[model samples]
Target: MIELNWEGVYPAVLTPFKENGDIDFEMFAKNTEAQIKAGVHGIIIAGSLGDAAVLEMDEKFELLTFTIKVVNGRVPVILNIAENTTKNAVNFAVKAKQLGADGLMLLPPMRYKADDREAVEYFKAVANATDLPILIYNNPVDYPVFVSLAMFEELQLCPTIKAVKESTRDLTNITRMKNRFRDRYKILAGVDTISLEALAVGADGWVFGLVDAFPKETVAMYNHVKNGEFAKALELYRWFMPLLELDIHPKLIQYIKLAATAEGISTPYLRAPRLPLVGEEAERINKVIADGIASRPKLD
Candidate 1:
């Protein structure tokens, strides 16, 4: 049976590259350790922040295999298998299941701008190709395709469709889905800035890039909200709001990787077609991150 046994603070890990730009397995293992040490609930591999756009098929499988082993069969590892083609993505999902990944999270098909009907068909295509539960990723910014609420209902009827990452950043859509499908599929927050608000609107948890920076803070805030400690959660949310603002930028991978470096985790390295944050933008981000860290509240 297709089941979405996923929840809590799952950080989309950055694919660490060597100085020569190859996938650095060592650094990737270390990053997993960092998240685990911080009490993160789970780990996601090969997502947008992992530089999925630039990786080849071999690199992807390697990362998935490495992730499964590094997580040591403890946390559920959700693999982002978003390819240009649904068939290719499904193939990756099947492979991930073979490697014992917990679930699959897919992006909206980006190359073709299909109508809602065709888009729904694309999801079915992937669903049929794999037995693992699927989480439909909706980021209108990168994928920029909007799946209607009706389509969401359709996906719910899909045997393999189990969750929605709901990156639409649409409050109305989020609220409507929460009301309509409250007892059904999982409602997860895909954006960092509104993660807490998304939880307010009934998100189960968050999959955020900025969590790479202050994972302990995010974990604390998540548990606080989950445990009904809203006052404490909101205080941490306000303190971390500035970093969340930077998470939506196109250079999010770059910025979060920089934050990882700041914490002595990993380097700020992105592959081709995506450049590192530079100039005044880089300086401003550095200052904001440093000042925010210095002034972050103590929840102890």
Candidate 2:
């Protein structure tokens, strides 16, 4: 089993697709390589950002296998499990480990908003099913299921559950988790808008979205904070705010893909139920990327 440090920048990457909706492996590799080259500490594949709900199991496994080869042990590749059933989630976890995944980013059971007991049981079942270290994706704002402090206390019984992605959109929870758990679970900031604050307040790491487009800038912000260069980090964060806000929207995949396109690292193609951005929305998002690029900071 790979040791996951559960710290530093980890991008939940976009799944590049052709206009015909086919997975574009070439573009996928380019973006993944860019993240690795930019010094991101880890990579997450097929999460909410990666269009996991739309991808078939075979495609996810193929992505997992291909990413492991492309990453070549340069950084850990963690797969996101968003299944709606404990059985399916456990099955995927076991297979992910078998396929060489270094860790997992597990969401609460999908579609059905499980209550506290149901959610804890779901998480425990997955944790017991495999030895892969799990990062609980606690995004109640989007996922509709909140993993409360009480719930986490029960989840502590599963030693394989190692971390929590704090996406409740409340920065105070970072303090709450630290005060309560005291390092039992590594806390990573999942919301881009408050990431710097989360880090300043002592989040172990950030699982970011815009890093898929602006890898260097994202990693630089993280390094700046870690090095105690608050002024420089805040400078970069202010510039990044517009693009970072894109990650919180319902069509974040489209917005981030457009940003990645401007950087020449990705194309703006997406599978349906999700279409390419058009008209006013497209023009506005394009300008945000353009302006950000025109004024991008010089980092060491």
Candidate 3:
């Protein structure tokens, strides 16, 4: 298959839930349409931002299938197929290819945390499972047992590992990996807060949940960075700091959904064991979102 270019703004599509806490497939489609209409580069379905861990395999397949059908090849649809086991991740990777997914954004296994070599073998196994390309989701905060900089460099040399979302605050690692494997791998800025900086240091682009709430603003920010308008991008990125801060949290799905509800697009419902934000928690989050919106730069 052709090499994947996960370059530019890709929104981690949210899994919309109805009032009864069921998957609102219709709303999910509408929201996806909105992103496409707004000119996002690609769509990442069933990610952490989509609350994928709680979703059943059937639900994940349905969402991926629906996304591919609706997107209709207008833009690439990359599935976020992640699990703790190599077998499960490999199975999902195989399924994603069958559904015609363009690529994958994979999170490292979190439970009990595996050792370094075991982790490397996990990704290599997934890569070998299917012809579909993979992008490492380097979210160290949530998945504490992250791939080391050495391991990432090693994966970069592997042909099937197409891209990487470098979430670590250590810009050093990004620079190191890019210097060594810039020709083979695309380094996507996984942290919204550091997109501009990462972009400056040779990052290809971003796989962002921030784009979920403010597509135009996020697009503008990336464009500004691309155009070397550091001052303007910095201005915009700071204006978006509140939403940026929420991204590193494990409950980003909850607050982001609430923010969407405040935007009147969807309700803030979440699946079992993962409660929706409420009371003072939601009140505080609402304030941040409202404040950000108030200060958000004009879209048009």
Could you give the C-alpha RMSD of every candidate to the true structure, in order shown?
A: 1.7, 0.8, 1.9
Pairs in clash, predicted candidate 2: none
Per-residue lDDT of 9 in model 1: 87
Lowest lDDT sum, 10 consecutive residues, model 3, at 1-10
**lDDT per prediction?**
0.81, 0.94, 0.80
Report the C-alpha lDDT of model 2 over 1-300, residue by residue, as the tens digit.
Answer: 457989999999999998888899899999999999999999999999999989999999999999999999999999999998999999999999999999999999999989999999999999999999999999989999999999999999999999999999998898998999999999989999999999988899999999999999999999999999989999999999998999999999999999999898988998888887889988998899899999998987
Instruction: Compose the digit string of candidate 3's lDDT tens values, residues 1-300.
Output: 223577888888789898787899888887888788777888888888898878889889988889888888878888887787888888989988987888888777648577878888888888888777788888777778667768876675467788888887778878888777665778888877777778888888888877777777888888887787878888888898888877777778887887776665556788888886778987888899999888778643
Better of 1 and 3 by TM-score: 1
TM-score of each: 0.95, 0.99, 0.93
Task: Go through the candidates in order and give the clash count of each.
Answer: 0, 0, 0
TM-score, ranked from best to worst: 2, 1, 3
Cα deviation in Å at residue 254, candidate 3? 1.3
